[model samples]
Target: MATPRSRGPELEHDVGRTPSLGYEPAGSYGSVRYLEHGFPNPLVRWHYHEEYELHLIVATRGKVFVGDYIGQFEPGHLVLTGPRLPHNWISTDVPEPGVALRDMVLQFGDAPLRQAAALIPELAEALPLLERARHGVEFFGLSEAARERFGRVRAAHGLQRLAEFATLLDLLVRCNDYRLLSTVQLQSFDDDAALAHISGIVDYLIEHYSESFSMAELAQRSGMTESSFSRNFRRATGNSYTDFVNHLRINKACQLLMETDRYITNVCYDVGFNNVANFNRRFLQIKGMTPKEFRRQAEARFGSAA
Candidate 1:
């Protein structure tokens, strides 16, 4: 067993072919892999695999997309996504773009966990935690402790790595500061295959979220009837088309508020809202506060950090 390094990039033999949503991590060394990624890695795209992932945002503030849930993320943030849940984290420009280490990740398959749980009563208690991870979990409290465990796990090997992994899971399972992200269950392979085409449409929306596109245009592009596309899109993403677009707009609005001194109205329109009143209404619905309040709190947080 080899000790993991802080700056260890993926070796050439450590990668496998990527499927539509994401690639399978090659478990060449062990069943559990501690992988790190910089900002500009190819794995940054929206993707999924059979291996469950425990991810830590080591640096950068960004908007994370897990299923239909879009929210802000910063350093020390920890999230767990179960097998086959599509997700991506897009970094904002607060810390510049050249940071080489943005994420510390761990990927392991469920079979080994279940096998171990069958023999260990305490490990069996973690089954519920893994079940809950099907919807994705963002841990809030125990952050510092969890961060320390992540560092330890990243540097350990052999039995030590497995021990640290179990400790990390125990902390997360008992923590009260976690929230389930997606509203739906894990999608089947066929469902994911069907949604692979929809992933392209999602990519387009992410790229051109501020621009307006007609339902007919989207339907034509997806080669489905408007009604059929709407149904499938909701089934895949857990949001209506309008609500999905609004979430994207609001996420952009959050980035602008956190990073710039722009007025709330300008920020709203810059993210594609046609009216300040509607923007404010939707923003409050999604974020639980007025844009002005959000900006004030964000500024306070950053200012204190600085």
Candidate 2:
């Protein structure tokens, strides 16, 4: 819970119209793949894959964006996302740059679930869980036993990995402390032309979040009129341009306020807000607390900022 250092040159968060599809090759052992990533890495981008993913946040706290849903996450945060659902987590409290272990992820294809169901008919009952995962599911307050189950899966190998995976799924399928993210099913496109324009725009905005731009400029870049660009952006992201930019700024401010020693006034300007009063208002609207209160509470929980 230490305050994250100033984001500096790092991108605050990632958002793109076309979610990048990720591929994980099956290792010599099994089809299921296990991955652990440290912060300030390249994988923390707005992307999706054909395989379903079960993700665990092992360290740090941050805001998680899955499809159109926006929320916060901390250590032990667990989420299951079905194929083609876009998701990313922006760590708000990584005290150093380089690398910090922050996530444990398991990814597998629907074929395995089908094969398991065919071998053990009763396993078919769990198929609904995969269907529900299309919208992404977040399990809150994982029981110690559940966490232990996740650890077993992470530590297992070969056939044992497969077994642990089944056990973990069974435990989660029966749990009721979870909620679905993504209010609706998002449509997918195979054509790169359809996504490239908006994706470029989103990438640019994320990289240059602290700067100001205009609709005319963005529209020109996208090869669309102002009205059409605005309409499509909202449709694709579920956020208007202003709100989308604000979301990025506020989350970046959260990291700076908690991790860095910068003054609130400086933090506000550093994150791209022109006025402290307006920054305070937007921070409260997004985080339900003023910057000072947030920093204080974070320190209390983490035993003082670094």
Candidate 3:
């Protein structure tokens, strides 16, 4: 990991790791669309991007994760995150009757945006917003005007997009009410070798559910001693090595239960659980439902065919 402090101007990470990924640096405007979807899953898997990101949640309530900080989210959230900061959005309150989940995301690569800050001292002042946005950059005094200014981003034109993004960033800088998610600069998740090791560990657990794996083995794969690897992995993702791998397993198990034609026993085995009984227990602990029950509810919510 190229050292990442929790709070500072040095926050930047690679974009290849993100799930809801999209970029348009090759275009004339070099602007990109930031979007979030309701399908596949309600959670945006924890990941980081290389681009400077400014997210404005257009609707609903949720929690934002930047590094280690978490906060109740509401509409009109205007956040600016520095490059490579790890973050994600999780909806806490689904929408009301007849309403769909309201979400939005915007991404911008550093290429076209190369000298955007150098050209504007105002943008430079907003660098703190990037640091603050790691743990979600909670907004207290900026919401009203930010909410008003953010609507301009949908202008559907190049110059308009730039102007709206500029407006959004400016609003965040002058706002007095906000806090950072992590205390250190967050560009730590950018190392390709480290990420490769992390990704391998994640993929390994996902493929082998019922088997037992140890942190030592994971560290060996990453070419680090157990303790050093543990510390760095946690620092990189705000998740302990074992806990993150467990979460990954649990997540995969839930997905299988929710969307598959396989039986519960089969699903458990398919997800790497040798102990079906234990699998049930852990699934309930994390998902609040047994495999059969989860499948039933998932059918009702998204359609059995889903």
Stretches of candidate 1 exceeding 4 Å from the true structure = 1-14, 17-28, 94-97, 184-306
Worst 10 residues of 3 by lDDT: 1-10
Which candidate comes out best when scored by lDDT? Answer: 1
lDDT of 3 by residue, 196-256 (tens): 6666665665567557778897789778889878877776656786656555566666555
- The parts of candidate 3 lying over 4 Å away from their true place are 1-146, 155-157, 169-200, 203-212, 300-306
Q: Write the per-residue lDDT of candidate 1 for residues 1-306, one digit (tens) a residue.
A: 223223111222234543321333444337677777677566766567788889888788877766545578988889999887767777775445557888878888899989989998898988988888888999887668877887898778778988898898889878887788855332223566558757778878888988878877987898889998888788766788888888888877876765566677778878999999999999899877888877665533322221
- For model 3, give the RMSD to the true fold: 11.8
The Cα local distance difference test for each model comes to: 0.74, 0.72, 0.58
The full ranking of all candidates by lDDT, starting with the best, is 1, 2, 3
**Using TM-score as the measure, which candidate wins?**
1
Question: What's the C-alpha lDDT at position 262 in model 1?
Answer: 69
- Model 1 score (lDDT): 0.74
- For model 2, residues 1-306, the per-residue Cα lDDT tens digits are 334365222222213211222223334447776666777666776667777888888888877766545568888899998888767787777886644567777777898778979999978978878877988999876645656876787678888988898888887788888887754222234545635676778888878888878879999988988887887777665678788778778867766764587788888988889988999999888767888877665443222232
Report lDDT (Cα) of residue 219, candidate 3: 86
Alpha carbon lDDT at 219, candidate 2: 90
